[model samples]
Target: MPLNEDLPRGDAEYLSQSCFQFHEVPGSKSVTARALFLAAAARGTTVLRMPLVSDDSLGFAEGLAALGYRLEREPDRWTVEGRVRGPAAEEASVFCRDGATTARFLPVLAAAGRGVFRFDASAQMRRRPLGPLTRALRDLGVTLVHQEREDHHPLTVHADGIKGGHVTLDAGLSSQFLTALLLVGPLSEQGLTITVTDLVSAPYVDITVAMMERFGVRVQRDGNTFTVPAQPYTATDYTIEPDASTASYFLAAAALTGHRVTVPGLGSGSLQGDLRFAQVLARMGAHVALAEDHVTVTGAPGGRLAGITVNMRDISDTVPTLAAIAPFADGPVRIEDVYNTRIKECDRLEACAENLRALGVPVHIGRDWIEIHPSRPRPAHIACHDDHRIAMAFSITALRTPGITLDNPGCVKKTFPGFHRALNDLRTIWHRDQ
Candidate 1:
């Protein structure tokens, strides 16, 4: 199953399937971005091992360099020279490609120092709102001026340093809002205390705090309020776990194809909320093994999976993956409480529904939920909407149904660059075994 020989065209239908023993996935984009922020604010050089090197993570690393932070990037490790005082450049312009972490986290990072920094992202990212995070920064006495849109990107931070204090935030839109403020907390004059009225993806905040502790900062959480001391981070060599969200594709693939796929480095001890996607598969009648350091998903015999109604607000990133597989389930798959998907990269709920409909699957769309009816999927070209999750998730459909294509398959560079190649390799192995 050589990519060029087996596939008819670029981003065409996939012609592979198999039960691979294991796969090595890239590092977590969420962890890598947070580590980059923390390392830049630490007291010593930070060595990040196996950090994700995709567009999003690289954009974050590049944003740091644009702000005058020293970084030495290699194949396996990246070393960032910490500067407690923030950006070395007095004036810098950063283009945050298509990464929400880069767009959301970098401006506040610049505010913790003395510099004039301008931040902008791709047109696609510019449409996402950051009003909550921006408003919180202003409340903390930081001068932030959005060049084009308020609470949106193409913004400038007239950095005179953040004298951080207690602030109330609404993290319902994203947890990165809270994590950004948290990463810069230790650098604040009075430290930082955040009282959150609402928060989504709470587990990501856990990852932020746990990673912060490893960098020598303790984040104290008393219910909804999180407190961080004004202490410099002690940079150390950190190892990033495999991205759980990215692993969702493989696990879901196993559950869909009656194959067994094991992903190393993400298990009971991992801090990603998306790891719960395996449990979602379990509820859908897949056999799942969650060891301390690895997770394996084996499909039910004959790939006969039961449909399930699950609320996916916490692990909403994998909603597209589930949506792609729902048509094959024993019953209609109803995924609820995932309104946040509408705001990511594209209106993911609508995108998933539209693509499902294209494949002759009946889909009902609500304000915060999508119900996908069970049916035999027809061959169709999927419109990816330039969202990486949309492309990667729908590619799973091509495994069983031929003629599936992606309008923008390259959009996966936002996280996993070699997604298609990796999936193809798995298919080749499965074919060989058969």
Candidate 2:
């Protein structure tokens, strides 16, 4: 799967010949999804500013609409009329498409209302395990029955209402399980106390708690226990920051191509933990300037970096981004503690390892880790697994190696529909300067 011709070899490598300041990414999908849920649970209309318009975000809104929630979606703004009483429709069948947030969060939201809700997801989502969240809901007195598989999607919730109290949850596989329960905590008659035995993607839960606070609900935490009182969310106008995870690709591109890429609206004040990927690049010899309102990454000397071992337990979403450029480093890039990535749209760790090997790089995969070694990468067709992150990450590899095309480039629609066009725009600038 080489391109028609190689554009960046011999004399014309896409280098740091230009500065790409004000490189803007789309809105945060995490913040947008949480905002939609909070808005639906509030008592007044919530105005969302600059929310992401992607398949995942739109699917969440479509689910809301199916449940009889009213919304107005303009070009750059979305307004949701709040309803504390839960789904306006007595019953609904929701297709979660391929978003894990929609698949996981909606069922619990339905549990808080007095209705029987049937939730099903795409074949990809159905493969992921939902047992932990389902068990936690069952423990809360919410009756659920799996239709096609045990502890899987294609399930029905015979919801009378949630009289939530105390529940023990093991969220080691996914943090959405914990976040979903926490989101529905206020709807219970007696509130909720969630004792988490294990967890992953802890930063996502932090996002949930922070957004919940913005909607005027307080969640108390002591060690591993979280306590949320019976309360109603207060609706308000909320501005969503740009996606830090998506910004990682652009930042990594800047590092590998010896160019400068600055992202606006995601700076030091950003709520996302994935912004820390910039520090990871900085540690690998990139020049990173994180201002109060923006962040910029210029490539390292000669677009070269020294590889290092890093733990991505908190910011695992950027694992693929880093791995795509690992071959350019001087040493070995070892990423650790990212097991939860396996349960995503695809097994991301192995997928990264697979594509790296396809390009003639040395890569090793463990149960929860991957180590990529430096080598002269030979371009080949990349297998994208239809995961948006996987497709976008490998597109970075094509910049230097060239001739790298994905089988499913459109998978980026899950969060970033315009990813290829945006990356190509920057690529065009870099190529012109060269």
Candidate 3:
């Protein structure tokens, strides 16, 4: 498939069969990309197997190439040659499109380079906030100027060696800021000491720690303070585990559609924090079986969905899936600890409520939490707001309703480029263009 092609659209009404077979481990592309960049920063050759080849990861690879790193991709693995001595930052520009992971990770890498370079992106990427990271970079003596909005993207980084020190951040918005600093902290001249205020999505930081260890870096954590030692990362072979966040949708499908779904690559031991989503499924009355390399979910008998309240700070990525399954439950479901969702690809809370209302589900939105009530079935075409999670969440509703049409279904390419194909592989699909 072409990189820029729109996602294929089809009426999900034809999804009547059960049982899904997923072969690959759901690799965490975000972790893989950051690990690869760190390997490159270490100036040694590193081999990464089963790394995610999604658009976001590709964007990061492109930015690294512009900075003088050579990356070779084989059918089964990728090799990155590091530019550990720092790249000559001679006025280069990288277009990150809508990939925020690229937009954030590359700037920190650029901060460690020699000259000045510009990083710009599509309209959506430009709107994503970069204040926390930009401020952190500035504190490290690196010159960073935003070309457009004050805290938004399309920024320039004038390279200088990192002089890390005590820093504080509001983690309520996005964990990407923390992830960016953590990945680059090992290269700081004095290392880094960070204090976080109101940190949200703490599990993501755990993933960062796991990746850091894989690259031969150790971070000391005492409560909210993280201390990094000035040690170079060791280049070694790494393999990315399957994306637990993406697997949430399939788990939800099994819970909602009475199908026995098996998502491979997520077993008893996975580094991704979103793996805790299986606990959420078990809480919601689904039968969950954890195997050595995969998880199997079976729907409750007679589709008796349970109601529970959860603070999803660590697993905020699965909020949309939870919201999609809310209407089928026996009582109201409350999802909290997700104020960060407001600034994600879209205002997920409002978008989810709006989409659920359009489908005739009674949903009440709060500043962070949303309460969803069961209602009579009413199928409607949903506006995805160009958010991949939103599009996937609503697609689950199609299984219960007559069929829910998704506008701009192609947004799934942001993460699972083969999402539609994977869905089709599980069942017979019927699609028609309007």
Candidate 4:
């Protein structure tokens, strides 16, 4: 498929005919990119198996190439030769196209170099906030000049050696800020100690720590204080896990439609924090069975759904999936503690509520929380707003009701490039062009 191809809506009924199955969903692109960068910074040969072969991962690889890392790609493995402490290509400009992980993590990667590197991206990536990361970098002695907005992307980062010291970061907006700093802290000449105030999405930080350990770095945490030891990342073979966030859609399908669905490659011992989504489904009256390597979700009998009120700060990525199935529940579903949704690919809270309202679902949106009330089913076409989560979430709503159409379904390529195909593997329904 071309980069800009439109993903047409196939018949929903056709989807249900085939059970969605994959031997292994590619490794976590987020983890792979971070690990690859760490390997590149360690000046050794790192062999990565099952690395995420998506645009985001590709962007990170490109950034590493620009930074002087030699990468050799095979059929299913990658070998990266790290440059350790060296200057990147003088004229290298990293074009991170709408990949926030690359855009955020690359700044810390570039902070250890001596040359100036320009970072630009697609319009959507430019709109995402880089203020927290930029501020943290500046505090560590990295000179960054904004080519446009003070807090946005398209900036020039002139590296002047990192003077790592104690710094306070506000993670109320996104956890990526803290993750960026944590990934690069050990490589700094002086090591790093960080204090976080009002941190949100702490689980993601835990992920960063776990990945850092996999690459041979130890991060000590005492309450709000994080200490990064001065050690090089070890070159080792690592595999990324299936994305728990992407699995939420299939899990939601089973909950809403009374279908039994099992998403393979994710297990009870998975690393992704979003795997807790099965517990949410269980709370909503779905029967959940967990085995060693798979989770099976069956909808409540007679469609007798229970309402839920929960705090989703840790698993905010599953919000869209949960919100899409909210109307099917017996009563109101209230989700709170996700204020960071406003700064994601889109303002998810408002976009979700507005898109639900467009389909005649009663939704009350607050600053950081949303309450959705179940009502009689009314079908309508939904605008995806070029947000992949919105597109996937609304499509789940169409499974039970008719007249639900999605505009610009192609937005799902941002994460699950085969989202529509996987969706088609679960259900059969009508799809009409508007």
lDDT of 3: 0.78
Q: What RMSD does each model have against the real structure?
A: 7.0, 6.5, 7.1, 7.1
TM-score per candidate, chains pooled? 0.95, 0.95, 0.91, 0.90
* Residue range 1-434, candidate 2, lDDT tens digits: 11112111211122222366645599999999999999999999999999999999999999999888999999889999988877888899999999888999988888888788999999999999999999999998999999989999998998888998999999999989999999999988999999999988788898899899999998999999999989999999999989999999999998998888778787666788788888889889887776556777888767988899999988999999999999999999999999999988999998998899899999999999999999978978999998999999989988898788889999999999999999999989878877
lDDT for each residue of candidate 4 in 34-82, tens digit (9 for 90 to 100)? 7777778765788887777767788788888887779987767888887
Q: Clash totals for all models, in order?
A: 0, 1, 7, 10
Candidate 1 lDDT tens digits, 1-434: 01122111211111112246555588999999998998999999999999999999999999999999999999979999999888899999999999999999999999988978999999999999999999999999999899988889999999988887899999998988999999999999989999999998888898899989999999999999999999999989999889999999988888888877878788677888788888888888887766666777778887787999999998999999999999999898999998888899999999999999999999999999999999989999899989999999999988889899899999999999999999998877766776
Better of 1 and 3 by TM-score: 1
Model 4 lDDT, residue 77, Cα: 86
The RMSD (Cα, Å) of candidate 4 is 7.1
Question: Candidate 2 vs candidate 3: which has greater lDDT?
Answer: 2
Residue pairs clashing in model 1 are none
CA lDDT scores, all candidates in order: 0.89, 0.89, 0.78, 0.77
Rank candidates by TM-score, best first: 1, 2, 3, 4
How big is the positional error of residue 62 in model 3, measured in Å on the Cα after superposition? 1.0
Model 3, 178-245: lDDT tens per residue?
Answer: 88888888777888888888677777788888778878898999998888887888888888777888
